[model samples]
Target: MSWQMADIWENIAQAIPDKPAIVDGDKRYSWAEYEDRAARVAQVYTDHGLKPGAKLAIYSYNSAEYMEAQFGAFKARICPVNVNYRYLEAELTHVINNSDSEALVYQAQFAPRVAAIREQLEHVKLFLEIADGSGEHLDGAVDYETALQAASPMPVIERSDDDLYMLYTGGTTGMPKGVMYDHKTFSSALFTKGFEMREMTLPEGAAGFGPLTQALHAADAATRSIPACPIMHGTGMWIGAMIPHALGGCVVLFDNSHFDPAALWKLTQDEKVTDLTIVGDVFAKPMLAALDDAQAAGKPFDLSSLQMMGSSGVMWSAEVKKGLLEHIEMVIIDSMGSTEGSMGASVTTRETTESDKTASFDMAETTRILTEDGKPVAPGSGDIGLICNGGMVPLGYYKDEKKSAETFRTFDGVRYSIPGDYATVEADGSVTLLGRGSICINSGGEKIFPEEVEEVLKTHDSVYDCLVVGVPDDRFGEKITAVLSVSKGTQFDEGALNDHVRANLAAYKTPRAFITVKDVPRAANGKAGYKDAKEIALNALNLEVA
Candidate 1:
């Protein structure tokens, strides 16, 4: 796994040339076609003076061209920076400029937005547009398809295992920052034994690459994954796109920019998608709703092809898991991971029994629960500790040494990345995750984490979704407020929900006020952007929030 991502793809393509690699809408690309197209993309970009180590920004929806751009950048030994499609013009410009991106590959539909901010991107030299039938083009941009067709497939360039793989994320707080990961570290963690590319090692000689390639091709079944989230997000790109591709499997991309639950189900049924990666309950609610609709209409979509459904980066409640379990017989994988580090823990649930509990995970070997003072917490200690990961962590946040030094650290000579997730190790060796420390509420000197309270609120049948934030308080310093949406026929019984929380958790931890909204605002990836939610709450309370 010390090889660059592009070289590995080349090796896999040589052995399994005809295996389907990517599917977007009606178009399907085989392994050979995928490699060839990626190479052509590489050629075109390199021809335009795109050099190795230069940053290339991908600002588009989920499409085959997105994947091609990613592979192309890797083959050219360039770093691909993921741009949040939801960003406003200022934010988008900030990301591109901050990343020092030399080129951009975006969708034709977004040409206007790109044009509006094109002058702000002083370092950008190339703009390759993917046609979405918008018929709008930038002044100096090249058509993505035309450029690929015109250029020869690039010869494999020199690449290093240490070549950067950059992903920009707004992890837990603040604006987005680029997290730089070398290929070897990212590939090793992603292509684990579970992914069927166990312990990827560089060959002793040229002969060794063949054996690994043959082994990859000899697999009887290939894993097919569909990411319901935008490919720009970590869950979509890493879990949905990269992992499946590394296994010599097919990645199915949703054609629409918006999430269509029915279309997701249809794609899974049609493609026999083995894995569906989502963010959390925002995605689950609609998907579950679609399933209910289909069943009631006497045309239930066949999800029998799915073996597992995984969610990360947000809360995935046990109630939603049970709802999905009733329809599909597959494992529900609830993972605790971050842009700054690899997965710390995972809770896998099957229909047979309740093995996965909400907010609880069996820790990975590379992770440990440590006290703030840097001492490991013993099981059953009941002491709150930060979840720290040892091996396979990112180098650091790109170019922000002070921030990077705070998040990634060396403790007693072993380096660890602590993304500020606080948790308690249970007596049974399970980790019960509290929410991020950055979002924790300190009310009257007692710290209350939002996820713990939110999870308790979700257990009530009347509640559809909820977000807990601390509001400015005169006496208590900050009062806990739960802003939530109720199920369509259920009344907003604040007292009942309050009683439920008081019973499950401490009285002080219960939300002092409950506000009912039509819906909680969520990102496309299904994460409740707490900063925005908090701002909304502050306005409702007539209190100022920082």
Candidate 2:
């Protein structure tokens, strides 16, 4: 069955044109208003000679226009590639060239970067600027609103489920690779298993679905979802932003850009947010700290409206989950997913037991893990190996067919999407994710996951954030090393930090050396850039290599 994303807006606008569809600070947009604006944007794209199936890149922070531009592109049947606004010239150029994007819809704040790369983007025919209050202007770019004003609100062109949307995965091994998804695969993989099944699914008519058919009847009943992470990231863009909107529910955009705990509290309390989605403890830690401060000050915000709080992108601590639950009266869920396989591979819901919480990974939902020998291991064995899957995996990397064919393969009659994450399946079928297999440290015949060490280090009082990596060691083959961001007004104590890890984890898992700085290096999605961290860690270890 072919499904067009434009149907989502059409259904919402027809049913509840006046109802609020988006809330960003004082700016509120009803379904009709948003549709009208989106249509105009589509027209604008058409006028700019951007035809259907053409690629358009959106580079901006979270805003109402971001959604408008995305839906507008869907209306035109043109693929919209959401670029990370934080990308530098080198990173941005790779995406622009890889996608062969013809137009770029960006915020005026990034005019300088645009100017720098304008000459290099040969395929880019138009630069449409979404003017922020910055009062910045580009020499050859047209105003976003002005361009839209000339175009008529043409009817949305119907697109088949086979139509493609490209999402680029964070490249720890090298440059980022574009992961393409058709509508059917994206919906079945990302929106179906974890999200649609968990919560109360909305009525069929509430969304674009007709009277409950067999396929629709089987979907989960939940209508609401929240994506607290940036829309540029996969979880944030796909699960958090698109899935919720496609369901015709409200998308609560946290526009603070910079995460301020108090601001999050205020937004939650004021907006009566139902589902709070986060990207690990980096986002949650500060909110928890704010909640603590609020309670101490006797001005605690009421977060009773929240039903479910979820963490993805990185592993969140059990301690942090407990702290967040104190403020929110709902289920605390931890999910493990990657851009390669869309969003959710496995999830631990509020119903998950305390014993389950102790385990580093959750069980697979629609996917499975296998060892190097291609044998599936029983759960709880601590026998870690490659993670493979069978589901709505992408066709392959765009343009790089060789790499794509290697990564996207079929084993034992099942097509698996293996992104090379190392994990152990528990006895009860729960999956314990060690870390990315490509970055796993093998020292003295022992496997060490950087994420495990990093999680423990983050809980340290003086450590703000940390990244663990394996550096070359003649004695152990590869020695574990940690690069950390110290908290404000704090000094690094290598011995104290090492002792802390030693108490919590095995000696082999603990970092052999520590380097402290003001901030830990990370990618746009908040995932640790181990390759970059390794470079810094190796330099630091070289001075003290013993």
Per-residue lDDT of candidate 1, residues 273-374 (tens digit): 998989888899889989999999999998888987887778887778888888998877777878877545464545433766788887878888888879
**lDDT tens per residue, model 2, 1-546:** 345567645765676566567877677887788899899998888888999889999988888888899889888888898788777999898888789899999999998998998889979998999988887778989899887777788676766777777887765677778888776676655555444545535343224343321232235332344567788778687767666565555677887468676887788788777677778877777778899889999999988777767667686777677777666667766667787873233444445534445326554554767776678776677777677866878888888898888777787888878788777776877666677777878898898888778878877888888888888888998888888888777778888898999898998788888887667776655677777788888777663433
- Candidate 1 clashing pairs, residues 3+ apart or interchain: 1-200
Weakest ten-residue segment in model 1 by summed lDDT? 197-206
Report how far off residue 274 is in candidate 2 (Å).
1.1
TM-score of each: 0.95, 0.91
The CA lDDT of each predicted structure is: 0.84, 0.74
Q: Which stretches of candidate 2 lie over 4 Å from their true place?
A: 194-226, 342-353, 356-359, 459-463, 486-493, 542-546
RMSD to true structure for each model, in Å: 2.2, 3.6
Q: Please state the error at residue 366 of candidate 1 in Å.
A: 0.9
Candidate 1: C-alpha RMSD to true structure equals: 2.2
